[model samples]
Target: MHDAISYLLFLVGTFLAAGVVKGVTGMGLPTVAMGLLGTVMPPASAAAILVIPSFVTNVWQLFYGPSVAQLIRRFWPMMLGIILGTVGGAALLVRVDPVWSGCWLGVALMAYAGYALIAPAFSVPAALERRLSPLVGLITGVVTGATGVFVMPAVPYLGSLNMSREELVQALGLSFTTSTIALAAGLFAHGAFQVSQLGTSAMAIVPALIGMWAGQYVRMRISPKRFRQCFLFFLIALGLELASRPLL
Candidate 1:
């Protein structure tokens, strides 16, 4: 009963954060949700529960936000990299230790969060940005497949690009959607898809959507600096949680 109560609390808090992240930044459901969920559940289960909601939220972003087609066309090479990397990552996940994988993910995310904290300006030259973007996609795709922590690489890349804030948000949204599809397929292939879990995930989507709407509202009131700060703080907390879980 205690464990059950903890699980319920985690689900509620995770979705609430998910919504806020999505609403404010127009992306980050998986990052925020999976991060929080990592504290209470195994990384695999955390990824599982987040999968459906992340997909739904990103789908919503793709439709509601600016010119997704143009963005996709501009980044097809990155998309292909994601596809290839995700397949390879999924294969590795089946063969390795998840705790070790989680540790690496936590370290990477902590580093990314640190970078976000210190960077005063987020601008990359178009030529270098274009060349680096696919590498980010490839790393993110593999990480997404293995640990469900796929937001790191692309977040900085998107931030560095010359797109408007809305466009950056949409790009993250689309990337997550692609990852969710790949993860779902990989999980099913690995026999990790549980009917009961799927049903639970479906039910959780309601609160997740609500939280996203709320987050969008919150985003307008906060400055970008504050948003980045809060985001970094959250990442640190999540990273510590991930690193500590195995020992605890």
Candidate 2:
């Protein structure tokens, strides 16, 4: 796997694909990278490859997105839940089997698909807003911490809120930031985190960021309806990948 040709092809293809997804969606670098690598590599290796890239891309969003303060204030309810949930998910990492962990990831992706298919509209009910917001965050955090892929329960709930584009960007940025930090810590605890992977992950960051930035430009050109269609399509694909992991 570490031979020159295989390594070169993996880096180039995965980097470009990850970047394209991020550029268009404002997130998904890790999802795309992990999905592509998961075809061949173990889940841990897939996750390890994206660590630096994920951290860098989220950092870019955290600093560059407009209206951070307003978004934080408005979204605090859900954010708090994410923090708590992430802690629980991270703890589960030590206790759970890797195969089961993979299955949990599949559940998250499938759940996201169901949500996207049935309730594409993001209008959260006022009652749900009061009760469900924190739970959504917790689920997002836990899934993120244990699985290294966070597509489900968290993103769908957040997507439902009536956030302006910039505010949405900020919320996602913060969520990913918390999750990444937790994931890094867990990997370190398991002796999976290494200085060598840092360099490789850093190298992968270039294409991932480029793809995301380019996607922003294209996103601006697309109308709202078209954008949503594309978003849902991507979510479906992500879901299938997760659901089929055992067979693969």
Candidate 3:
């Protein structure tokens, strides 16, 4: 049917755009995809579509970095917390109305956009990282499970660690990968992840990969700082748009 074709086209386009953002800025695929797709689909369904692409892309990003073992050893507590929180939050997602989820998603996007605009540069003391990492991880995981957007206190917390650019990117990949996997598991447990959805999610990887390649090419030619500012502004607009949906 025409409607089916149109929906597929939209899915491809959404993932492609999301992939480009991730490739250029090292994050935002799920956030962007969920924000756009949730307009047409349930939040739970949008989250289902994200599982495979997010996992694959983030794993690629994770292995691209050095010292994986060291990072794992350093961040295990946080990882564990993410798992626990996602399991709990996914239960909440299943119980809540989809409209409420959309509203939460909108608020989350707006908050993250506001933070990105401010762009603070700060560092956590070494002692604090050990104490706070799990807490941040738990919060990010709950957000991820409920809204399918996982970059909250976690990203900012990682940024606060004052890592080199490459390390930061790799660390983010690790965190995202963990979140994606946990989210998938949560969805599966809740019976929201149907086999057909898995197939669709797998197919989505191709467009995402293609867009990532294209975005990398663009990244080579432009100032990332400028591009990021533009992207943040766009996200602000998107957040506003999504937020207005329930109100209107």
Candidates' TM-scores? 0.87, 0.80, 0.97
Indicate the TM-score of model 1.
0.87
Kindly report which residue stretches of model 3 are placed more than 4 angstroms away from their true locations once superposed: none
lDDT of 1 by residue, 1-248 (tens): 99888777778877987888778766667777776766655566777787788888888876667688898898877777776677667655554566766775577667767877776676778878678878878887887777777676777777778788788767877777788888777766776666779977886798898897787787778785688688888888778767765686
Please rank every candidate by lDDT, starting with the best. 3, 1, 2
Q: Considering summed lDDT, which 10 consecutive residues are worst modelled in model 3? A: 87-96
Candidate 1 regions with alpha-carbon error over 4 angstroms: 1-6, 120-123, 128-131, 222-224, 245-248
The window of 10 residues in a row where model 1 has the poorest summed lDDT is 87-96
Error of 1 at 156 (Å): 1.2
Give the top-scoring candidate (TM-score): 3
Tell how far residue 160 is off in model 1, in angstroms: 2.1
Model 3, 145-186: lDDT tens digits are 888889988888999998888888888888999999999899
What's each prediction's clash count? 4, 6, 0
Tens-place lDDT digits, model 2, residues 113-232? 566567756588766777887778777777776767766576766677777777777778877876777677666666666778887888887788777777778778877456656655
Candidate 3: C-alpha RMSD to true structure equals 1.0
- Output the number of the lDDT-best candidate: 3
